[model samples]
Target: MYENSTELAENKLLLLHIIKSVTIPISNTQLTDIVLENSFVNYFTLQQYITELINTDFLKYVEVNKKKSLQLTQKGENVLMLFKDRISPSKLNQIDEYIHTKIESLKKEFSITADYLPANKDSFIVNLKAIENDTLLLDLKVNVVSKKQAVDLCTKWKHNSADIYNKILNALINE
Candidate 1:
């Protein structure tokens, strides 16, 4: 039983460490995939640990680019630094390696954002952004009279952001 508890503690630390080591905030899905791939913890238990960390103010869940993402708080970083030795050096290296491999794809995942809000009773305002390495390449807002148009714009933005960017740039340069 003592060993099990120790393992749980290590898992929590591991989770925090992984979050800190990454360049961008991670979604729950990304966290789950990495944890399950590297650790012995199951999905439900992993979620429980995440909740406990959030409740304790060690981790904060926030919407980044309109998607739920996990970020390590300063308290979490300090705690990890204090107990990080309990996790082996080799394990740390493995975590770093895994994140390094996935870094580019993860950046791409969060590089675009789309959201809508009610502007008034009759219209909705859609916000769209395209980002690269923390730089905002495009920020657009459109007002439409119907929610369906707002939704469709968001969907199309997600699918064709690159093409849209090129066309806009080409128009500006040619004009």
Candidate 2:
């Protein structure tokens, strides 16, 4: 029983280390994903741990661009710093490798943005963009008569950007 409790404590310390290692605040989904992917904790258990951390003031929640994310509190950082040795070097390396491989894709997923603006009482303009490495690769704006159309276009652009971009380049090059 003592051994099991010790392992649980170690897992919580490991989680704190993972949360502290990231430079930017990460969404709860992202955090849970990394833990789940590494087989460190089950989903329900992770949720419980997250609740416990928040209750203990080790982790605080914030909203960035209307999305919720988790940031390590000062107490959380201090706790991790003091207990970091509870995590094995091999496990730390695994966490590092998983994050390095996934961070770029996560950034790209957020880079494609879409929005709509009221052009007039009867018309709206939908603007969509795709950015790579901080460079704007595509910016398309279309005027539509209805807000629904504008919103639909924006949703379609986000989902079909690669295909649409390829088609546009192909048509232009052949012309």
lDDT leader? 1
Model 2 misplaced regions, further than 4 Å? 1-3, 110-175
lDDT of each: 0.87, 0.81
lDDT of each residue in 31-97, candidate 2, tens digit only: 8888998998789888888888899988889975455878889999888888888888899999988
Candidate 2 overall Cα lDDT vs. reference?
0.81
Worst 10 residues of 2 by lDDT: 104-113
lDDT, model 1, position 11 = 82
TM for every model, in the order presented, reads 0.76, 0.69
lDDT against true structure, model 1: 0.87
Which 10 consecutive residues of model 1 have the lowest summed lDDT?
1-10
- Per-residue lDDT of model 1, residues 99-142, tens digit only: 99988767766887788999999999999899987788989899
